[model samples]
Target chain A: MTESPQGQAPSGAAADVPVAFQDPSYLAAVVDLLGAIAYGEMSAFERLAEDAKMSPTLADKAELARMASTEFGHFEGLRQRLADLGADPFEAMAPFEKPFDAFHARTAPSDWLEGLVKAYVGDGLAADFYREIAAFLDAGTRDLIIESLADAGQSQFVVDRVRGAIEDDHRVGGRLALWGRRLMGEALSQAQRVAAERDALSALLSGGVDRPGMDLAAIGRLFTRLTENHSARMEKLGLAA
Target chain B: MTESPQGQAPSGAAADVPVAFQDPSYLAAVVDLLGAIAYGEMSAFERLAEDAKMSPTLADKAELARMASTEFGHFEGLRQRLADLGADPFEAMAPFEKPFDAFHARTAPSDWLEGLVKAYVGDGLAADFYREIAAFLDAGTRDLIIESLADAGQSQFVVDRVRGAIEDDHRVGGRLALWGRRLMGEALSQAQRVAAERDALSALLSGGVDRPGMDLAAIGRLFTRLTENHSARMEKLGLAA
Candidate 1:
């Protein structure tokens, strides 16, 4: 499996040129990826806020609110970067709204614990997918993609809350485990739709001869890694993934 | 005609021991006031995000999202201050949840223009009311309240959007004017309910002998100021007050 370049390229891939973004197509592809990520952030902000309403306590509500705000921060960062690249952030973001919105609408959590699991499991899968895609990009763009994912640091709070809930009622673990699997299914269908529609993003994963591209097998392994990570996250929450 | 203290104290008041919060009741009152403001921020974030959905364009949605995030930021600041004062931030914010939630529920905007008007008119009224009440506090608390209000900055986008829409369709102006009034009415009803229910908050405004406070006439004058500001905001947005 070819690892997405990230900052760890084989000796000197990005070293030849300042970055892979010099090519207009590469630049546009990067922009498309960033735009998708930015829209994802906006969706997270709105979805998390709606979920916050289901919060059982003020403390719980505050946590979800903080998560929403953090997602907004990432969106802003991505938006600014898109602008810096001479792209209209709104137009850049427009194409991905449907798939993202559909994903959210279909996977809307039924309760607070489910919301937590959705956020944790869903975000984990998306981040892993992006991280894999990040490997085929220039260091700078990959770094930005990775950094945006990093801000969601330590899901320990979500882990504790989800685990604690299941501990209180073992039956919850069974329900939530099913919920996690459904979230993963919805996410994969959405991602597949997005991949079919977004040619540039697909190109990012399967790069050209001049770029660090993933072969068909590597792409399969990327999906494998994403699924594995998702299961690990659910297991962390004591859910059978 | 009175300037909200902000950081200024009269010749003798807030002088004896530096501030009135030395008294336990005053301390509780200040904490209560901060809690209300913090929870107000939380409500604003949720309400603004909901309103953002009614945005006619992605740009407009981004503007409202920025406002929502700013409100969340203010909430975080106030929550931190509550913690610094040895108050449980969530508990301190608990008392305010009902009133703020009621205000939001009763004033949820039906569309983009109405949302803008609500954000403009409703927030303007609330800010004015709080600014007036801030006059009865110590400089530090007063400054914090004032700063939290300040981050809202000028709602120039709302003003421009509403005014532009009204210019395009004059009927919108009349409808929004009514909305402005309805918002003011709902806000005042909620305010009165909160004031009647929260004795500490009421006491904060009508200070005890040791602290600077407003007389009945002064309180009436404060309402006058609030009404005037609300009218001014509506007018700025090209709506009738």
Candidate 2:
């Protein structure tokens, strides 16, 4: 991957760019990907903090605050990494602002339960998609992406609360199942829009000269995996995908 | 400070309590103080995140998010400390929730500039009050309070932005000056209510047998100091106190 067709190391990439990301297109894609993740984390932080205000108990509020803080911490790391790569973090994140904002606006949870479902289901789907893309990146960038997506292990409480609520009344499950499907739809639509708009990010999946890229079949399989995981998550939460 | 009038260490203090905080009253006051600070930090986090949405520039939004994250980090620390002291952090925090909520509701900023002023002035005032109370606590608790109150140094951007707006329009200065005063008024009223209701917390100001407590004159001086600091912060923001 380090040597191109000329049998020499590629040199046009930024001095700080890793050998694996020496391709300008590859570097651009990584930046775009990081930018999206950073902004996603920031948006998640905002939404989670907002949901915290609706918590039924102080303990639940603190838990949500902890989750928000964790996401913000991930954002700080990505911001610093962008600066280290000589990309303006905010500029990197700018292109992603609209789609993310739209997604949040469209899926604004009506209450605390819906918020938990969104956090769990939405984050689960995004994490799955990012993990799929991480397969094509340099180890360093991939590690950062995976670390940023690490579950804070607060999901159990989300699952517990959500499942407990559904058990109290079968009708609650029916309503949340619809909410889960809505979140999945909105998420997929936003993901599609992001893919259509970010050429470099999309190109990351199509192999360049030195990298192994996924074919259309693999891309289909990736989506299948993402959908399957989302379903599994919804099932765990006593909701339907 | 470690010994009582009987020339012995106080008993019935929690086993984990520090020697200087073994006076149950002092311990309760310290717990109350920590709880108030924790809840205050949590509310600040929410307000700052809310303000980030109103930020005119993406850069400004990121800055406010950074400040909000820092406040949440402080809240986490105070929460853990409360638990370590054998206090249910949430229960300890319960008493102060109403006043803090009322303060935020009453002083909700009308615009981005107003939010900036409130963050600067309100946080500055709260930090000052906590620092004053810190004086009556044990070394351990005092250090914890001081650490939690440590500024994240994001205030310079707030100062620059507010002052720049005032420079561009003198009318902004007049309006913000009034906003700053309103914030101070709302904060003071809420704080007085907290003081009036939380007996142990209020007693923290009245030095005990083992510790140097503030007399009424000293108490008056503390408020004077707080008001002076608030005015100074307002002046720094190019506003009237």
Candidate 3:
């Protein structure tokens, strides 16, 4: 990952570049998007650590706790990366705090497996979105995003565990599949709410005259990839579409 | 701390070896004692992570989560150490799990300050006890015990925050002081119960053969030291003894 050169636009910069960074609207929109995602990561870490207690045995408990700790590492990475971009991590994240928080509060997991499902579904989408955005950033910012992406290790563990549980208990598949769908719905709904309010960010996704090839179709492609991965994960867990 | 020499008389060894380890009658008692402590640490970690949400900001939340993570690290260390001693950490910690769980389950902190007070008081006692016991063990076990002591970085932060709160509202001090007292009472009561049930452990504490140098006096000294430190902390926070 390389940081974008300051002042100098890329040879094939997106047409929307003038609107994405130079325009106040675009900067605010980008900040809003980054802020919401950063806050979500922070809250997710908290939830994972708390949910770890639901493990049935000491070994499971230890593993879950370790997994949860990785969230903080991810949170820190995101925060520092945001700081590198000249944004206060808190300020960038503050606006979406309430909505993201309410989402989790309303859907708190009832058990260990449910928590794992939340991690798998929620973090999977977050990582996908982040990876897409990282594609447009400068070297330093791209590197940070890539580093932050590594924080999803524990989420992968959760996916494996949830899949194993479903395999072992075929009856659980229906309920968990429904749970996964709900998680995605809530996540996408919240994301749409964020995108609706941040036009500059939407512009960044749509790429501009500077970069003729960028557009909402790219965003659509990103979402398609995320849903595909999510569907495969559900099937691997013995859950239906 | 060095390992006790093989074939040495148990009486000649340091008073730290719970007689239950050598005496069948004392095994259950020792296991129950260690298990309760282990479980207590586990529960505390979970509660602390949950409480981290009350932090006024994301950075604060991260700090609290990091602190909570340390508890899990300690839990793992203790678990591994127990396993090395041929005891299952979960099994050894299981007999009193209900009571210990009930204590924490009932006393869950409602706010950041309350949580900090719990950490400040609870961790103080644990560190005190571990420090004293370390003196009685062989070099390796003692070093392991010392190394497993939970770091006070998070607790100190909590203490600072709690103290800052008390400075703004004197009444806050009274409530926290009372909470601290109750926490200590429950902890001491549980300790006594475990002690009474395990005579070899009791004997190990009481010293090899007689009462003066036994575990009780050591416990008493530990309590004194803990209370002294607690008093200083309370004074710093403007809380009444």
Give all candidate RMSDs, comma-separated: 7.5, 5.8, 7.1
TM-scores of all predicted structures: 0.91, 0.91, 0.80
Chain B TM-score for the candidates in order: 0.90, 0.91, 0.77
Indicate the docking level reached by candidate 2: medium
Q: After superposition, which runs of candidate 1 have C-alpha atoms over 4 Å from their true positions? A: A1-19, A151-154, B1-20, B151-153
Model 1: per-residue lDDT, tens digit, B122-162? 77777777788887777777777887887462588888888
- lDDT, candidate 3, B183-216, per-residue tens: 7777777667766765655664555532234445
Q: Sorted by DockQ, highest first, which candidate order results?
A: 2, 1, 3
Count clashes in each candidate, considering only residues at least 3 apart in sequence or on different chains.
2, 1, 29
lDDT of 2 at A36: 98
lDDT string for model 1 (A134-165, tens) is 87776767777887886452378899998899
In the order shown, the candidates' DockQ scores are: 0.54, 0.56, 0.45
Candidate 3 local lDDT, residue A213 = 31
In terms of docking quality, model 1 is medium
